[model samples]
Target chain A: MHIPSWLLTFCEYLEQTASLVVLLPLGLAFWRWPRLPKTMRLMTVYLVFTELVLLASSLVELYRPAWSYGIWHFFTLVQTLLFFRIYYLTLSSPAVRLLIQFAAVGFTVFAFLDSLYLEGLQQVNSYTHVAQSALLIGLALLYFEQLLNELHITRLEQDPLFLVSTAVVLYFSGTVLLYVFVNKLSAPADYASHQVIYTLNSMVNLVQYLLFALAFWYAGRTLPSQSRP
Target chain B: MNSWLLPVMLATPVLLLLALGIVGFVLRYQRRLLRQQEQLRQVRDASQQQALEAALLAQEDERRRIAADLHDGVGTTLAIAKLHLSTLGQPNLTEEATALLDQAIGEVRRISRNLLPAALQKFGLPFALDALARTVPADGPTHVIIEQRGQPRRLDPKRELIVFRVVQELLGNGLRHAHAETIEVSVDFGPDYLSLQYRDNGVGFDPAAGDLPPAPGTRSGLGLTNLRSRVAVLHGTLRHDSAPGAGSKVWISFPIPYLPADQKPALTTSV
Candidate 1:
């Protein structure tokens, strides 16, 4: 496939910048640490962990390129667990929380299987990524249903969990396709596929971080939350 | 094998647009739901206000009936008894008995007037308020001072009654509970509003506690709650300024609708 060099450069810059945009939310979360609710605090922890993982993975890539994929495989599992914790805290239904607890255990087992047997550490684990996207997207839908059932939230825009769930749905659903074909298409010589993956994923990732920053900023401004969870 | 690079590139923007579209839809739908909720709340509030207004009107009607009965039936009967006693010319009938009969008649008249202020109905709020202040004896421990500002104009009889009741309660609470020494009431009539300021050198309370010192013994008598209801019906704003040991001051402002000159019939009076 013939791809424009300018587009490739833009995609590369966007990819590098998108990951660091998590700092916006991270700074806000820290600044408003005392005021944030349990869910928002948990999200802050995820943000911190993500930044750490990004830094660690970059270092590993420079030192040992072969093991870089292993770091992301670990990241996939941790990210799922953190999100489960976040949603579990916000969702009011006891049955849903229990279902999520079970889902957490189930996803952990699947992630292990994918790493050891299905897609090995050297591969992109497109199956795991697709599954993660589907599961998270499902959780986001459940959250939306919960919001509808409980209209207690007077200001939906300021609600931290609402903002976070939106980011989750958009980011996961946006990047699910990229994840699905990334393994097969990421051959060393397939420059066009790399551009497609980096460009699409980075754009959505930037949006996710910006939304996250807004959520954190709102949480900081209002101390006594109207949201039940 | 077909290269999916072209398809992926094309589909990615479409997917992003789809996600953006979903977010937009959710926002619009939620706002619509919220607007519906707000509209329902407004309807509920309006219904409640109507119910409250009806209850207050019924209470006033009842008061008027009771006052009429007391004055016409009870007072008249008492006066006839005094007349018959005087005509009997009995030796056993002492002067004390005659004096006590006069006091009883006076008491009945006072109670009847208290139930429904005929002065307020006949004259206006300012006149009724002045009459109320005069009820506080000059020799009494508490000295009442009434001040009026701007041109005096008559309001709707029902509205005057509401304002009268509010002032009546304030004075009653201060006299009965606080044992105020000097009470000052200032009434300001703006071009389109009426404001009242009441200050009493009484045992003031912490306004922050949001509690009134109980003035018991008057059942069906308008208390602070009823006072607030009356103010609400008038669409008036009330504020309190006081602390423990300091004198309490209350400021009330009620918007008065402008009645044009052609609409003016028995509306203006001397203060």
Candidate 2:
């Protein structure tokens, strides 16, 4: 569990600067391309919301760690709901849309109950995190399948939804097992191991957000002419 | 779990997911390329079809103009000359001179008809085709037969001209190239289509080879190309079946267009 000092510093820097690196481009894109697809615009809003929650949670953690955990747990549930809405918009099938809606609602309820009764606000919400990651991974895979099935997209690289879905698949699949075991790495004795795990998680977050920036930029450049419902 | 196995286990799925993302992007890129290729093909085909239609329309216009000139200009002068010759009732006129003047008038009329047949515009397709069949020498090597299977229907004038030209080209090809003993031209008016079949027992050539050198004393095979272009303008199908030593058969089918009630009366009256 011995953590390297450089790794801890790198992780801290990533956590502190992620908002600027990720959210700035997305916000600028939203500003520039007011006519972007509804799903893309909502994604930018969700990302800004996530950054706000991260900033607020960090401040709360400095004062009271337990309260910060609660905020994060609530944020996780909100993020899942937002993602479900985004996927619901992109996907064409009614059956899949209904399934995602049901899963979103079910997961929100489960995360709430798990935070209150099972994992509690003091501990890491590892169970809900793992479940969210698993579900997002499934949705990402489904989005790719839908992409292939429809084959209507003329330029995949320029499609904001396609780019965001690719980022989701990569980041969620990479972090699913890590999140599942995050609680184990939370002990005071495992501080070093926790930092390492979190650092890896931060790296994944950085890559995911970079992809989001790319998607937003693509939308800003192309969405005015290519807007769809 | 072994400490070493931890990163390895984590890295495996991450790598796999990254690989999957790459594959998804590659697949999408390929799909985009295929879509672009198909679109390009469709555009090329559309332009080609447009060009063919324009050329065919211009050709039809030119033929009509020439037909009018031959009829009103040269034909009128020939009629006047004949009238003037007939009025000369003097004994000085030799029988040879009288017969020669009559022959010259007949030649002018025949040339005028060949340029644009008056029967085609005045009567309709069947009469025009019959007149076409009559042009073939009765005692010549080829015997031409015209047959109608179903009830004849008059089509739009433009479409009728297209069909007429197609048949004309096919018949001309058969007589000039096939060197066949018999040529049968059949017209069938189905409820949904107007079908024409031209069959001739001549020195047929392979249609797949396309535009092979004609036999001695025969012209090049440009008529079939023109025939195909004319058929395409009507959105029709033209099939040529032939082999060397066997006769050639050209089948042309054009869809029957739905005419408005007002147009139907004119077509029926014309028929």
Candidate 3:
């Protein structure tokens, strides 16, 4: 099925500009409330890395198309590590922490190997994307379970960690199928389908960033602390 | 399995593991919370017990002070007044004035004895109870009987006074409220504990209804509240057996700590 040209153009515009709109307030919130949990502060740093990579990749896509894949691959590697670190800090169980650590190390090694020998820097790193999405979805579900088990939470909407976990679960679940089928759909004949599928990805990205912004706003209202274990 | 089903199978186990992990975490967390709450309750109960003990001790000290004031301050003055009246020569004194002064002295002595029974400190609990039984006038409609079992042994003086006061209060309640004809007081000494029993043929009220006097500010059950508190202070139990139209029986027992050979009392056979 074909998407309307006007709506597609609008989605593209939102994809490009959503981060700036979301990040400005989120940055201000972090600046206003410096006592956010150590994990959240680290997440702010990861967000800065994401924005920088996005801008660099956009510029490279316009001028040097060949290098954009390399840039994207590198950013994926870093983002996976940062996501693992965030979960490691938030979770208290040693077994889960160990599982995440093993997954992070295994993914890093696999990505290194796939980039060098198989996909190289020119192809989409679909393997790493699929693995990362699946891992994140699982972690997000675990986080929700933990939150529910807590004896009390004053307001779930105001809980920054709850918002962050929701964003992760929603975005990763939305992209799991697209990442799994990326290689099959990369042929030039499938260009229109690719554009439509990626537009969905962009829309998911917009929601994810908005959720992050809301989480930061909640964080600004109070010091970031874990709910009862 | 279909090619598409491969990821589904892999993801299924991962999701299950995550759920199991969280359930385990919650169970451990809840157990920890229960233990903390249990510890908090025990601490609160211990502090409350300590406060009750302090209040009981303070009450006994205050009673001793008031009793001394009545005996030394009031009793001495009334005795002096009686002596002065006698000193007036027989020719100068009127029959009416002499009888009035004698009656005034007797009333003062009675009040002083009620405040703090001097017999409780001088002798032991059995002796004090006997003296109390004698106070119910023999001519009155009510008959008083005193009974003792096992060799009588002296307890700690303070404890003896507490037991005496409890009995005295019971007797007073019987005379004032219970229109009974027979009041029997008995003390039994065992190897490890002592028991005091009071049975009266009074118009017994319902124990369930708590017919005792109301405390000053609160409408708590029967006047046994004070008796209950004293018994608690002694680490003892107070049981009341009564029903409407049936005579009331109160039984109180206190554990006796082992006394040193030097502190043990010489045996006494009679009440």
Candidate 4:
């Protein structure tokens, strides 16, 4: 795919502008105060992973014809997979953890195989995106339900856990909407038609990054008070 | 420019801003409330201490007035009566009459001593406490035991008096209301704290469900508020634990910031 120059410029803007302007402060917070809240820690980890994806996509944008879309697609796939992994680890159920690990490994293998040969099959790619979106929503829902149901969690509304979880819901809902609907209904056949989608996607990334910062702030503040053994 | 995408795109900013506004308001409100609560607590503690001091001073003045009246007026009258009685040898005075007159003198002396223990001024708090403890009857259903632990350091006279009165009130309450089978009173001295614990195996009241109003006449009723005030002056905390069908326990701990280094073991000075 000979990607359009305008689309390339937009991706580069997101890659550089969002990384420095959005993710940098969050990174600083993570560095300066390593003892972030649980929510913040999880959000930072998620953002760092997403930032890596964006950085990879940026590189792909600059390289143009030499690098295939498959590379960027694979980046998204791996990031989403890692996100789900983070979700499962946080819940900390031994049985669920084992189950997610097994499922993820199998899914990664399948995604890699699909990336190698399924470029001609756009529908397969779409279906894969749908699956990732579903997983994100499900993980978000599970995290929310756990936070709400915990009886020992006094001052739940003020809790960093609740804040970070709310952020996660926002990011998940926004991302799912973009992935599952925007491309199908709005993007034209040409790469130029996808510019708006790219811009919207960057805006979503910006929102996600900010929420991640909040999560970090909350986690750092609360961790010492609870003082888990 | 699809109608659907337009509405979603425009609403996002407003929703995000609204959420931020709500968060800021809640945080500010909580902080303000916390500050107000702390201020209120300090004010309440200050007023309570002032009232306790005024009450103690008034009580001391009343005690002194009673002691003076007994010594100057009553004591002189009794002495005159004794002198006149000794002169009754001039008449037909029987042995029974002489014995009765001698008993009256003994009773007068006992009353005068009970009214004011001269040892309280000379011996200080530990001696006074021991004297009071010795007077506690051992024949009741509740066997009261007193244990003084660690080195006893001398406290200010006013503090000692307050402690004495508080302990007396506690003993009275236990005997009258608690119907306790056994009562153990302990004074524990620590490096920076002096603690008193009164434990009784008695029919306790539910702190949550029981009457929240202060019990009148009992130490817990009238004297506890005063006791708390005295403890507060010394930066202390008092806790009471009781439950229906269970026993009652009172724990009071206050700072002892000025204990002398060479204090002796005050615990062994018991009846």
- Most TM-score-accurate candidate: 1
DockQ of every predicted complex = 0.45, 0.07, 0.02, 0.04
lDDT of 2 by residue, B1-271 (tens): 2253367456746665774766577566657755776788789988999999888777666766786676688767767776776788763674566677677667767877776667776766777888898898899998999888776766676677777888788888788777789999998878778899988877777666555765664344467788888888888898877777777778889897634434542432221
Off by over 4 Å in 3: A1-229, B1-35, B91-95, B211-221, B264-271
lDDT of 3 by residue, A54-128 (tens): 899989989999898899889989988998998888877799999999999999998898788777887888888
Candidate 4: clashing pairs of residues: A36-A219, A36-A220, A37-A219, A37-A220, A38-A219, A40-A215, A40-A216, B215-B221
Pairs in clash, predicted candidate 3: B212-B222, B212-B223
> TM-score, B chain, candidate 2?
0.82
Candidate 3 local lDDT, B1-271, one digit each (tens): 1233335335534644554454455445545664575588689877876687678667666766777676787767877876776778673555677677678767767876777677776777778888898888999988888788887777876677667777877777777666789988788877878888989887777776576553342222265778887777678899988766677898999897535546844333211
lDDT of 2 by residue, A1-229 (tens): 3456886788788765764677665665667567677888788778778878978987997988759788988888888888999999888899999999899888988998999998998877889988898888788778877766655565776778877887787777767767676676556666556666666676677778888887887775543222221
Docking class of 2: incorrect
Tens digits of per-residue lDDT for model 4 on A1-229?
A: 2446876686768745655656554665667465764434555666666667667767876886346356556665776776666677677567766767776776676666666675432322554565666666566556555543333343445565555555545554554545555545464454443554556656666666665555545554443222122
Candidate maximizing lDDT = 1
Give the winner by DockQ: 2 or 4.
Answer: 2
Distance (Å) between predicted and true CA of B2, model 1?
5.4
Cα lDDT tens digits for candidate 4, B93-180? 6455656656765665555555554555456566766776777777867788878888766765556655666666677677777778
Docking quality tier of candidate 3?
incorrect
TM-score of each: 0.89, 0.55, 0.48, 0.47
lDDT by residue (A16-82, candidate 1, tens digit) is: 8997787899999999999988888988988888888888998998999999888899999999999
lDDT of 3: 0.72
- In candidate 1, stretches whose alpha carbon ends up further than 4 angstroms from where it belongs are A223-229, B89-97, B206-222, B258-271
